[model samples]
Target: MSDSKHRHKSVLKKTDEELLTDDLTHQLALHTRQGHNKFLSESIIPLMLCFACPFFVRSIVFICDHCHGSIHEFLQRLLFDHTLTLKDVLENFFFFKWHWPSAIIIIGFLIYAIIMTMLLPGDEYQGPITDTGHIPIYRNNGFCYYIVSLIIFTILTVVLKLNNLSPTYIYDQWDAFLSTVSTFAFLLCFCVMIKGKYMPSTNDHRSSSNWLTDFYRGVELYPRIFNIDVKLITNCRYGMLSWALLSVIFCMKTFELYGYTDSALITCILTLVYLTKFFWWESGYMKTIDIIVDRAGFYLCWGCLVWVSGIYTLPCYFLVTHPKQLGFQLTILILTLGLLSIYINYDCDRQKIQVRSTHGKCLIWGKPAKIIRAKYRLLNGKESESILLASGYWVLSRHFHYIPELALAFLWTCPCGFQYILPYFYVIILFILLMHRAHRDDQRCRLKYGDAWIKYCDLTPWKVWPKIY
Candidate 1:
């Protein structure tokens, strides 16, 4: 106990950055101790809390009512209201009547996700279904459910607000709750439905003439035009679309909460516009818009969009709708930060691409030279060589691009405010996810590049960012 207390005191005395680093180390240590099952255990508690909190509060209210004039008054009447228990105090404000349907849905989804995570193979596979000869299964299911749920939830929320129903009524805005549950459901399903085992590895060295032609041309022209290559474009579009849609929903709900002019229409239009841009630009214009993105692009884009927009924009929309609930200055600050981050990230990517295209070879400090060659095997057993330009941005940091990427994520999520535990959840999750991805990429490189990778790592030690990370 004494040792533990001393350690706690030492941690408390550290600078904020040091403390945060320590916390991260502690979290990673815990994961190491617990193994991969740590994810399951970490998630189980939150899932339970989401369902259990409402029930726990309801039970307390029920018991309080039996002996009291009013639960609040009774609590106040006893031991001085100031001395009320933390549970009683929380029950007073964030109380909600338990809804069996929502609870069951949440629990069911949680269970399904756990099963899928445990049972599914880790190997990548082609999706079972295709749209226009493209691998569209993940996005199709995720987006379809997201759109359907948003429509249903919006309609229900409008009806409830018009009827002057209490916000605490579970059915009032049940769609938001349900959509949350369903998103997890699909994510779980995606994990379980791995088809990648049958699919060829990206690293396989083969000729492009036969198999590449078939794989690329098997899809219809329209889909093929959208750059739906299995090796490059993964299932990130679905995640991005889902997050953008969810943001609109949150914005609409915020407008409703504030009794302001209905902005749902505007929000919907913006969402559609972004989705269209994403499909058009991300799908086909990768080389035009920016370069260097590969399979990782899909995950990076979607992860940032969904996690940040979902957590930050949604709650802020509610607060905006109910301005009394949140301060105006803080809201503006968050929005500004998001805009800044986005601009920086986009500009950085553009500069990198433009420099590479214009120079033909990457230039570092006016010196032009090649560091390494990338060997790609086509589907038909032919080998091709592409130079890996390690000079320009690549020389600065191993993964310089990730710096702006993470910054953008932080900016998008910062607007969610510091008032609730839920808002900060995305930040925590993203940090861990990105770190794990970096580690995986490192392992892949170690296997593929052998000695060359060691040299590259030595030259550019930083993985995601410079110095700090």
Candidate 2:
């Protein structure tokens, strides 16, 4: 064989660690990595919300006396009115109070969740390779942890009433609990940033040179502490698990205060079903943008810790006090639509998983699946192939799954009725988030797959909504 051909063969056979240390291959990897921008979004906005969200929930949703007015009028009085002052804002919106009991419970529960994750038996799944040649090994025990935790919590709160702990504890302490979770988010972000800088788990990390950027965007792709995956604990266990628990907690609160309101019950049940769907398909999520591309920084870590805990449950929280009848017909209509959206969303994910797992050999919608075998080169100069799904819901839009996701959010929020827009905040935020994610995913794929991605886009036309987006 020729000397050049022999050298290429040797390079291809090198281990991932050796390939990463090779200077030429490392340089090739850098060329494929995408750049991060939008400094205002990455830094300032999230910081402001980190402090502001709790205040909004407490003052506006929990204690606001201006519900009699229209949302426009409420905003006008709060923001545009000349009568507004710093004193009023401080007194109403920025009051800080600490409740040690609630704070301790919140902290203890997080630690307990970590313990559960460590002890739980889970299937092992390997994530995609990173630019630095590290592939994350995740323990897919989320569904197990979720079910076990719920059972334990139900026994403690409802069945046994251990230590006088009731399901309504979170509801009764909502004000202080919100503050505690938010504070934890801030602290968690700071600790994660420090750890990423000094004690990253692997070579798949870098400093942005700017501390603020490093803090906002995260320093590491995959971070671990004491052999525990930080994102798995924060994102899956702490964030998503809290979202599910709070839904039931809010439902319990509604039952305690008012009778069993159909609206609140429907919202809570549907939200649980959707979250159950999440845990079921979580392995797919580990490969998506949130886990794959985003680093262990404030945007992700703090979001899972705080935003998922607080904002994701806003509709249920709003319904705790503001129960609605919705009657029989309306309830049936909303329930049917909500359940259908959940199934479609689940099916969309299933289709892609099916095609990828079977190498496009499976039938989609009773026909042979269509796929694009997008070819690319890894940092080692070795060619690789990725399947770009084009069958089932994927044929409708590049991110057709997101459409059903947004619909599910709206359906759950619908129980709150149109009397106030506060409960619909989740729907609005989800739309914006999913839209941005769809765009970001496209850009990431384009950078990774180049011409093959372009061909896939040519075949799929729609970005998210068919013939509209």
Candidate 3:
């Protein structure tokens, strides 16, 4: 306990630069001895809190009297009237909602995604090495698959509408989607708890003896079911596909209700384009922090399955009911600005990737790319070399890419106007997410690159914003 206390104090005594560099990397030693699962208590709790969002969205946004209504009443009564016991709270929210139609939809979609993954044209990418000696290879066909899926979806929608056979009640799929995904997550957890034959991820800490913690952390680094990569299927195909489709449906519903309004249209167009861009840059994403560092745990799996499709569609989701007509001039300006931000972000990422690919031999902004050679040790003890580009957008701010990305998110979100707080939820979340990611990436490099990281940080001082942050 004394040693742990001293270590914590010593960390606090470091300089601001050192602190920023070392932030989030140093896991404080726990004084209390616990099972392996309990070791991740710090991480698991935050993830659990994030879990609340799905239920909140499903219950509140898409209100069902049987489920959320009772829960809300219970909460209000407890807060303003009487105290509630633990059993009361659990019982209040524990009714099963079996939307048989949505079940078919979810199952059919999964089957469709698997078929598309098999048929689509994609390059096999070798990711960063893993604890298991095998290097992870993923088939990235999201762009082609998404395009084909969208076309087929459109044709079906059109065909059904012409014959007046369209499934209108399908609009209520959000609640059902939430319920079905929750079941999948729980079942996955149970599977992970019992199955030890799979290749589990190896990390700094030992495996937790606690079943729930082990399940929460995941039993496999990469779980393959019926020859499908769970991460790729859940994160890219199911989540991204659902998010995009939901936005489309919301916009269509808005048009059906209020003729044609530019506000909803603008949001819809930007969202579709943004999602398409994501698919186009799918390979680039395969090497990101989420895929490379994060385990295939509940944080990621449930997030991609449930939270992503719900929360990410908020801007357009709100617009479905509250359609406003922004004039042509304002619409043009917003679109122009958004497209520009998207371009800047894409180009910035392209420059960094190209320079690294070319070993700093390429030109950046009409000048030779300048970079500091930095070496880092992988989690598995293998050494890797990377050159930090100090020229172009990176020199302006270490995370200049985030600025344009933020701009892009904000401009699209502006269509919601100042009338309601719900639409701007994405903008606020994006800001926090970016800032947190910047800190995490910096800390990771500080641990990995050591002195080389310090030098790199010195060269480009500003983390994101110009001279402010």
Model 1 earns a TM-score of 0.47
Worst 10 residues of 2 by lDDT: 27-36
RMSD of 3: 5.6
Model 3 residue runs over 4 Å out of place are 1-40, 43-51, 59-96, 131-134, 189-206, 379-381
lDDT per residue (tens digit) for residues 343-435 in model 2: 999999999999989999999999999999976555556666789998889989999999889998999998888877877878998899999
The residue ranges of model 2 lying beyond 4 angstroms of the native Cα positions read 1-85, 91-97, 159-165, 380-382
Q: Write the per-residue lDDT of candidate 3 for residues 107-196, one digit (tens) a residue.
A: 788889988998887878876654323467778788999999999989988998999766434555655656766666656556643543
How high is the CA lDDT of each candidate model? 0.41, 0.79, 0.70
Looking at model 1, report the run of 10 residues with the lowest lDDT sum. 216-225
C-alpha root-mean-square deviation, candidate 1: 14.9
Clashes of 1: 13
- Rank the candidate models, highest lDDT first: 2, 3, 1
**Highest-scoring model, TM-score:** 2
Q: Candidate 1, residues 146-186: lDDT per residue as tens digits? A: 34545655686678778995333432444334344334433
